[model samples]
Target: MTAQHAAAGQLQLNYWAEARLQRWGHIAVPLSSTRVAIHGGYGRDGKKLRRLDDVVIVSSDGTVAPTVSSTPRPKARERHGAAAVEGGFVIHGGRAGGAFGDAWRWHDDVWRELRCEGSPPAPRWSHAFVALPGDACLVCGGRGDAGDLDDDAYVLDPATQTWSRVAAPAFPVAFACSTSDGQTIAFGGGRAARFADAAWSELALDDATAAASRRLAACVCATARPGELVVAGGVPADEGEVGGVAVLRIGEDVKCVAEAPLDVMRAYPVHAAAAFSGDGVVVFGGGVPCLSFAPVFGDSVRVVMT
Candidate 1:
């Protein structure tokens, strides 16, 4: 694996060898400055299919260890959205036996269900979520029960333990990637087997992109620099299940500053995860490319330097 500096302040990714065992559909949330917490996903334990419930902590130096939580654990589910909040990490809406509207918070080695006032978004999975300013989060678009896809949006204030619906998007999307750079939240990608709308909406800017567009089912993270978003590991509409990555500068003009191919091909509806490190981003497990029944999971981690 090698890293090369790129033009436009974009970081070239160095693909490392597979460092962890194969797993996908897991959620990775930053637990502290140097640790990331990985939650449930499906993988193989021996010859049988396994739905995992263990909490694994990944250290800054690339160490993966299990954490024993003193409190109750959330249900084992995949395609969940997780983000670090004020007091802890909040995970919301994933598919277990079916879509879920329940939310849980993990803090101080404990897991607690978050019962919010008013209504929350409908039961869904594969939604896009980003940490908003002031200890809040915005969740938008996901596949609902019975194959229903939604365009709705909602905001959660962990401080108040409340949820409020925001204006829905102009077009429905799911399994899309999203990231926030303090001031703006940008989303891309859409459902599998379809091209995402060419335009993406920026919540804070109250604007959408006009010329730049690509269908992606990737994981995304913000760089240390403002107004920069990095998207990694997803299939493009034209590329089928091939893995692709890109960096977007969301400013006066929203455009892709850099683009490249992932070390391997991946598919959509795969629950991949990303977290920003000191000066780069780390992407975790995603579903391997498939053309038939059942998906082969990926066990590697890729780092993109910014």
Candidate 2:
């Protein structure tokens, strides 16, 4: 594990590690204090892309294990979104041959397809799905069927299995990452998402450094401290699409953490999965070698406070 000095907010990058046979565009969410569950991704090891037919659980000790679901789960998918909720993780909208509009939940050792009463969000991939307070969920912006980015948002009430349009402006991005503290949510990719109001009300900018970042693509992020997030690994707009490990702050100003970026011991880590565990943020699984279509294996990188 390579170590770096702490600078920005006094939080140091603990070390870099390898990732597990996950492929590109999979969904990942925290399962426990030291482990995260990764599901559904595709690979093009040769030429044609296909779904990876399995679920993987990654532990902080750098161990990767196959998850044996006692109940049947959804078919292999890619570029979908998953959020940790009260009982289990809720997954929604992604693609294999084409984009999907279905939603499912993993609970009680079972997988159940969620049938929305009315028209749910249109078929999409890489949208942001997050758990909200009261166990509700918010769905927003993603690449839609017509190959256009969506500009709408909706909230799902788990109790009623109903969808309500959020009375606020939607996130202007797709393929971004989002996390919530049951009160505030932080999201973004090419741009930063708001995280302050418990209602996810329109956010007020910190006027700090959220304005300093260039639009990034395929970036992953996790909420760290309250009102703070740790963002890493994205392709900058003008950088010829090469992935890098630059650390970015989304909510408040760029404060703690080292000034240097964190990188993987293996893959280039674009389109990776991220979740906060203990004092550190764990980044794992993605298109290895960056733009190249390769699978991730072994240990995953962890960025922790010193």
Candidate 3:
């Protein structure tokens, strides 16, 4: 839990703690200013992948403890999308052997699966599921049964518990990472992470380092300040390197937090989870140390802010 003091305007990725399991693709939800809850992820078992089933709580001091539910829990999963709102935490779509379309909410200390009205989105994984303006959420493009889906975004209106498809081109693209202050959202990434509302336009990012900041499945969180975001580990477009933490402001150039990106940061945390709590953003477990038959897993817990 130790940290080096950073310059006033620069944000640094400080090592927070070594998590219990070296897992990746987990969901991290900020329970409060001082607490974060970690859910399922994938861990390596020899040459195979094992789905983790542990629920742990992490304190600001870097202590870890396992937690369990009195009621039934959702089937162990990874690469799932979750949104932490005022009332509860909503999670959807992930794979455990196959893709899942189930929607579950965490409330009253239990994992309760939601029975939605109308049909749900196709069971898919590696997609974007984000919390929007209201309590409703948005789900878009992921790898579906037939293969990579086209740009069809689905909105889950909690009021009706039904899903309606949104035909915004900005979506699915924006869906990759949506940063909001609960009033508006900023979307699109790579090369030049654009701030778009409903329209889609490609921005050529020529900087290799900047372009790779937060690619597919990178963790994102809106900072305490409006229009500022912290981006962390993911597979970069160039796929040059595997680790780094950078800051992206709507109208400013991307800024790398530290002189050495991986000096204090975790590597290749493609589907790592992030939550904005207190004055910084906490990043949990991520992996893909190497894209080989026997891949390495991660057990990293770090935080950064700008």
Question: In candidate 1, residue 94 scores what lDDT?
Answer: 83
TM-score of 3: 0.80
lDDT by residue (1-306, candidate 3, tens digit) is: 445545333655555446364678788777777777777888754466678756777776677777766467788888888876664578888889888888888864677777798757888877777777667777776776678764576778765678877644443442344555443233445434342343344444335434644366677766666555666776555464655666555434444333226542434566788777656777776777466566565445354554
Candidate 2 residues lying further than 4 Å off, grouped into runs, are 1-11, 14-22, 43-49, 168-171, 174-180, 183-208, 211-216, 241-258, 288-299
Whole-model Cα lDDT of every candidate shown, in order: 0.63, 0.59, 0.63
My TM-score estimates for the predictions, one after another, are: 0.81, 0.78, 0.80
Question: What 10-residue stretch in candidate 2 is worst by lDDT?
Answer: 206-215
Q: Show where candidate 3 strays beyond 4 Å.
A: 1-9, 44-49, 170-180, 183-210, 251-260, 264-267, 289-295, 299-301
RMSD of each: 5.4, 4.2, 4.1
Ranking of models by lDDT: 3, 1, 2
Q: Report how far residue 107 has shifted in candidate 2, in Å.
A: 2.8
lDDT of 1: 0.63
